[model samples]
Target: MNIAIISPGPFSVPPVNGSSVEHDIDEVTKMIDPEHQVTIYTRKCATYPKSSVEENREFIRYAYKGPTPYLQKIIKHIRKHKPDVILVENRPTYVLALKRHFPKIPVFVNMHSHVYGSTAMISKAKMKKVVRLASGFITNSEFLRRHFMRTNHIPGHKIHAVHLGVDVSPYQEAKLHSSIKKLRKQIGLKEDHRILFYAGRLMRGKGVHVLLKAFRHVSEKDPLARLVIVGGTGYGSNRLNPYVKELKRLSEPLGNKVKFVNFVPSVKMPLYYQLGDIVATPSVWKEAFCRVNLEAMASGKPVISTPRGGIKEVVTHQGSGFIIPPKEWSKELPIIWELLWSAPHIRTEMGKQALMRAKQFSWYATAQGYLKVFENAVAKREAGKQPLQKTG
Candidate 1:
């Protein structure tokens, strides 16, 4: 099968430290390439290092620079390639572009999350219309799928739920000693201190402020605990928000215990995950899914996440990690403290269990899910065009 994946994001396979959407695109393409031809389309935001390079299997990249007729350019490429299936990552702009340009091309959209909740890209009404136009819709979690149906009136049959994939093989029963020492030395981590890690974009919906508040509670109990936040470039208009500021303030009392690193590439992320004893994601908004949680789990680290959207699917209360009730950090803090104080052994056991569970989710599974969607899209397209026969 020949497949084309379109993304409105800044890069085609993500430069390094990119969003979960970019990571998903990369993983899916790599997984499917062995059995199928795959190509990725991304916005020409800036100059890439190379025009094209074949890394693994059969994968190709087409990037355009500047903002000159992007939709027209994409359409031209589609016409030239005549791919068997086109999978467009669900961004509001791409939805409109596909609706206008690739109407009959059997476009399958991978809906990352509900637009009504946290993503400030499209409004409720617009999102509904986009879902209606898609030939097939996919979401990472059932929560997002239900949100789409409830808000957009989309039928249940129209949506496919495929949870995000992870590579558990590389991390299965792996030693963290080397990775830990490297990351610790790089980030100035202390030998005796226990590290609590948070990985994701330092944005509003990620709940950086909530993390700080909870950190304060955690620090009150274990003063030596260190929180390492990784991501954000600290560049231009998307500068530090109020949440980042609030975190700085909250961490002040704890002195140098809180540390923030901007823009750690995805290649180096596994090390950070290895160094962490626990991973925390306190996102306040409804996330489509959190890829960081999967990485952490695969690295044999227990996770602590607020019950929100797709996060619940990845975290289980006292199973993989603690899934606290929404907005209940005050009640949740003690649980975090108990784990920090009494259960170092449980942390090791749970970390191993987390890695084992993470194995069930893999990129091959993600590719298989998309391939099914593509097959369905082609079948549906053919069925719609079949001429009606007169009844005898």
Candidate 2:
């Protein structure tokens, strides 16, 4: 089958920097059946050429003149390629346009999150039209699926929850352990110190402040414990924004206990994970799904995350990692952090379980699942059957 993927305009295909959705798209497209051809439509970037074909897939970058012209170029490409299945990512507004202009093509909207920059300003009427036209909706987690269903008043059958996956080989225990010493040395971390890592955007919604607050309490109890924060202000931002500045202010009294590192490339993430004894993902907002938690688990490290959105589905309490409610992070996070900090045996056991759990979620498996969904949608479309209509 020929597949066309429409990536959001902000990010590039194959994700030179850190884009979880784009990375997933890249992984899944590469792992799809060799016989199938995949083409990704993404915004033009200096990092990538206008059009390139490699890894059994083609990437075409569209210029960002404006929404109308930008989408026109994409429509032209879609018409030229005439893919069997169209996978639109996140932007419902674009899906609306695609469905209106090219109704015969089976289009599936892969919603990465409940909110999208492109569809934020779109009216509810237009959104309903988009939902009605798309063959089906795909969410990364059950939590997101349920949330989308409830919030959008869409039927459960119309949406499918296919969990995002990590490439577990690089994060295998042996590989992670092999690089730990050198990674620690490079970051000026002492061998004896226990590191707690947070490796995503340094923003308030990500609960970096909450993590810092909890870390302060943990540091007071365990003098050897250190917190290492990775990443800059959200995606695409290269500077230490106000949020990072506030985090620095919050970490002032903690002194050497808190270390803030600038953004690390996605490829180098395993080294950072290897340097840490525990991973903390204290996102206060409802994260549709967090790839950081999966990556950490794949690296054989226990994660301490909030039970927000689909996080509980990933991090089970006392199974792979511990999940504390966001509201109770101040009271609960430090205690859990202390527990993992004090007991190396427990942490080691949980780390093993984490690695095992991580194995269950693989990019190849996710790709296969998506293929099944795509085939079903195409078959239904060809049969002149209407999509599963949304009913309250």
For all the candidates, what are their Cα RMSDs to the real structure?
A: 3.3, 4.2
TM-scores of the candidates are 0.87, 0.93
What's the lDDT for residue 294 in model 2? Answer: 95
TM-score quality measure for candidate 1: 0.87
Top TM-score: which candidate number?
Answer: 2
Q: For each candidate in the order shown, give its overall lDDT on alpha carbons.
A: 0.73, 0.84
- Residue-wise C-alpha lDDT for candidate 1, range 93-134, written one tens digit per residue: 566666676677776678786652233767766666776777
Query: Which runs of model 2 end up more than 4 angstroms from their true locations?
Result: 117-119, 173-182, 385-392
Off by more than 4 A, model 1: 33-35, 44-68, 95-102, 116-120, 123-129, 170-179, 233-238, 383-392
Q: Any residue pairs clashing in model 2, and if so which?
A: none
Over the full model, what C-alpha lDDT does candidate 1 score relative to the true structure? Answer: 0.73
Deviation in angstroms for 82 in model 2?
Answer: 1.3
